[model samples]
Target: MREDTFCWGIVGTGRIATIFAEDIQQEPGMEVTAVVSRSRDRGHAFAQSQRLRATVTDSINALTSSGNIDAIYIATPHSDHLPATMAALQSEYPVLCEKPMGLNVAQVTALADLAQKRGVFLMEAMWSRFLPAMNAFMTLLRQGAIGEPRALFADFGIDVPLAPDSRLFNPALGGGALLDVGVYTIALAHKALGRPTNVYGRARWTETGVDGHSAYTLAYGSGAVAQLFGALELNTPQQAVLCGTQGRLTLQAPFFRPECVSLTRNNGETNHQYHPVTGNGYGHEAREVADMVRRGRKEHPTMPLAESVAIAATMDELRTQWALQYPDEP
Candidate 1:
């Protein structure tokens, strides 16, 4: 490894971690040098598959204090995000944790506070926000291509089998459509509308006690609203739309990682655009974190810690409405 290369230490060996490792490998002057997993055998296998010439351990402490890693990425299950991220921050490591950041608002807020006190760089891996297409969409909105924004509609639903042992339906693993894919819808809404004046939601519970299907509406002070839906028990279009006084923008299916968007104005004028990504779109966030760390910044402006806390609060409110609580959550 080059002395100037930015080395990363990953805290999980799951699918997302594998994707991250793959994407980071495509970046110049960056490398995955260490990984932590509960199972040493799995960690070793992951390293070999990813072709990482790095350490494979089961301890977060070892990864954080190796004196070689420049930053850490937490890709563990939802329930483990808090503990893993906490360990990284306490060890004075910059962290880019996966979405939902924590199980609830309290946990997310605590992490933000700790990172602030340490003056270290900490950001939620809301990777979608950094996508090329999403950025282009935001730029158009800002330039009034959609006029005054008035409403939004988005949903992400996939039909996964009813396997109680899988993380999707397991309460102990922080399973549920809301925590898993629903955050994308809410995040897009939050990006366009900021914090909602009020949040209204309803959920259908699974036999395992977690939410199976759910819907929510966020109300803003300017009379704007966002309608969002998510489900693990059903399949949906997985599209999104933003309506304005004079026009509307629609993102193609699987909107969270969209490549195309269409804008139609009231005057019957229309425009279509495409924005492509490199390496599954995970490298964008990795590069952003590396730039911020090298610049000595403590937080990302686009995916700030405060906004992550706010989004977690919104999710907490929805869980409260459904009377759903994870077993391990305090």
Candidate 2:
């Protein structure tokens, strides 16, 4: 809350939380002031490794009660985002939660409404939308570089060893391929095609009663369709393609962390490569949140709350189609 810097409180000590802590340490105007984890030893170790002056605690109430943090970053699992975010909002601290934002659309809407009522800034940590390359790509699309994006194909999948109780395969933990990795593809599709009129999905479920692989086809009223695939049992190409009447755009490997894009037009093929980002590409989102809070904004202009709701709705519909229900859903 200081004029020159923002003090951040991290709400989890998981893998992603560690990455975000490191990234925050690298930024000039930000500091990790506290870290909350169920394991006191892990929280203390994380704080020590980052050389951060932090109040490490296992309870959410204890972490938020310090009344010293300017903002909180929710790095817990998708199922835990809602409760953790609510805790931060109740404490009058703005929140930046990692995507897909929630286990379902209702959770996202409730959080957005709560943040609004509390007059606190809330942003979903959809880091891809904050990347420089994605920003440029959106600009090009708006400028008719691709002549009205007509179709999009995106895939994100990985081969993970099957452990029934692991979060990735556990139904009680909101585990599935769609929530795990397909959310990225769905977000991109929604970005290019808007909300779909209809969604069709097919999945291969694991023995542990969770989806191991899945495919989705979304039909838009504009006569465009997006084909998306995600899996935990296979290693996919994990690329994104946007095709229009005039040209096509291809994002290289790791579409979410894309650093290069190729555009093919009637004139010729052009390749654009973005500068390598510092601090594992998470600094972009951190800086974005800081800028928004500094300007007294409630949400980001690029990735608004409505977009988050629509993306969650799409996932909800996809889940309905595949008959895949997370324990958290109802």
Candidate 3:
């Protein structure tokens, strides 16, 4: 809890949890002091790999209630986010939850309400927003590097084993291309253009009836349009471009992290490359959380709590248009 050294209690032992652990570990003033998994075996495995001298518990309550942890990071599955986040916030622990805060907007909205009423620090761990490349790119856009942003073209796609058990194809676990990889594309669009005045979506479903390959277009109140795409059935460029009246910006693969970034103004183009400054570029968000907690702030100004709820709402609208609903959802 000290300002100079923040301790993180992580919940969930998934792949993203590993990345989060790595990123938070390398932060100058942060350390992951504990981890909670569904099973003791899984918890110890993560503890051993991360090489932490912290407590490993199978119980979310144990980790959230511990005085040893200064903050909580929830990296559980899509369906599990609400419980983990609710538990942490209810314990009065500051929390940084993974993106898509929950399976739907209603879930996240309630959490936000609780956070507000409880006066606990809470934020969606939208790591991409804190990336060096992303920040710089946004700075350019603000400076009219891309004047009057008119359109955004973004996509993410990959070929994965189509097994029904896989999270991408399973409807019961809140799995689908839109909620998974597609979220990244949509998040970027939100940054460039706020909420759209209208939303539309269409998708090709998998055998399990979840979204397989899909595309959507968003019309913003500013008269700007964002064309987005996502797919688990095939491979895509995984790139993005924002076009405007004065210029355009192009982001390389993994547009969220953007190993490469470029700016074009009326015909002249300049490029910049950023290597992993830290573990998977997630350390940026970790550092931001530490600083915010140090300042006793409840929400990150960069990725405000309100905006987090809005993104979830946008996703809900998209899913509705496609008539796609997870088994556990209405």
Query: Best candidate per lDDT, number?
Result: 1
Candidate that would win on TM-score: 1
- The TM-score obtained by model 3 is 0.95
Global local distance difference test of model 2 = 0.86
What TM-score, computed on C-alpha atoms, does each candidate reach? 0.98, 0.96, 0.95
Clashing pairs in 1: none
Tell how far residue 18 is off in model 3, in angstroms: 0.8
lDDT of 1 by residue, 1-330 (tens): 999899999989888999999999989999999999999999999999999998988989977667789999999998999999999999999999999899999999999999999999999999988888888889888999988999999999999998999988999999999999899999999998889999989888899988898999999999999999999999999999999998998887779888888899989798989988788888988999999999999999989999999999999999988888899665
Q: Among all windows of ten consecutive residues in candidate 3, which has the lowest summed lDDT?
A: 269-278
User: Best to worst by TM-score, what's the order?
Assistant: 1, 2, 3
Q: How do all the candidates rank in terms of lDDT, highest first?
A: 1, 2, 3
Candidate 2, which segments miss by more than 4 Å at Cα?
A: 1-3
lDDT (Cα, tens digit) per residue for candidate 2, span 174-273? 8889988998899888887788999989999999988899999989988888999999999999999899888988877788888877788857777675
